[model samples]
Target: MTDSPLHVTVKLNAKLQPEHRHELFEDPLDALLESAELGQLTGGGTALTDEGEVDYGDIEIALTDPASLPGVIELLEQLGAPKGSLIQRAGEPDQPFGVTEGLALYLNGTDLPDEVYEQCDSNYVFEQIVERIEGVGEICSWWQGPTETALYLYGVSFETLRERIADLVATYPLCQGARVVKIA
Candidate 1:
């Protein structure tokens, strides 16, 4: 099945002049598109000839996976976006998925030993995984519900994470039923 597209909207800071809006958001938007392997804006644009109607630094894109957001956020941070620059889902009321500090691996179904949890927590496991692959940011483990335990990681390349965790679960039977989740 095709993944549902997510609308990524970058709204400019008011301090930006209308004339500079396109230049400011253009590269970041392109970076988001390139990193996500996406094309085209979903909706909205500034008036070309009417400066009075022009809005500052707004760019929108439709991304294929919610997981792609972190890369875009990282790129925007690198681009030196203004303090009030906003990234959000186009039509949603809640904050955008990009706001999530990290990705989470939700492990449920198996009731592993407490010692296993202590030893294979996100930080320890992330350290092990990153030795084989280069990944940045923090990760740690914790319980989310009565039955659900999670391994949360800050920076992620989603596919890399899935493969790494699949390997981890292969060696550690305790995580056999883990499902990668994004916690925003």
Candidate 2:
């Protein structure tokens, strides 16, 4: 059986102002699912349903190729215009550990072989992991900020991440000023 493309659902906080609320969808069907799923995930509305509760509160995107994830994430950031906080993860819910800030990249350690530190792309790494472990192996998610937006990705590759970062830097001048945190 063919596997389903990874599904990402982005939920915007209810407190955001109307002006900041905007919607961007790569596919119409995925957009519809995102709206429905986000509403369900966040619950109805705190006030009333008819009040037009935060129109841009949710977003969804489907990804098949892991290499395409970083680019997809860059697009989401551009469309949503994030203000704060970006996080990424690798693998499924119970077993996920690679996380990155600023760029919204994550890697799955469990999926990798003991010595496979570098790979062509995050997606390739995931694929390799899957081959060894019998699971799909690539998963990632991102959040724009408090009331900004959130996104999810699956089957992503490191080469994709590098390309995406380059694209982001070119497209968003602000990315040039981004700082990476290092631990000793």
TM-scores, all candidates, are 0.39, 0.27
Superposition TM-score, candidate 2 onto the true structure: 0.27
| lDDT of each residue in 58-119, candidate 2, tens digit only | 43445454455455455445443233312233353421122222122223324444344343
Model 1 C-alpha RMSD vs. true structure (Å) is 16.0
Best by lDDT: 1
Candidate 1 local lDDT, 124-175, one digit each (tens): 5546655644454334223344466555453445455556556775776556
Candidate 2: residue 68 Cα off by (Å)? 1.2
Candidate 2 lDDT at 109 equals 28
Candidate 2 residue 83 C-alpha distance from true site, Å: 2.7
Which ten residues in a row are the worst by lDDT in model 2? 39-48
Model 2 has an lDDT value of 0.33
Whole-model Cα lDDT of every candidate shown, in order: 0.53, 0.33
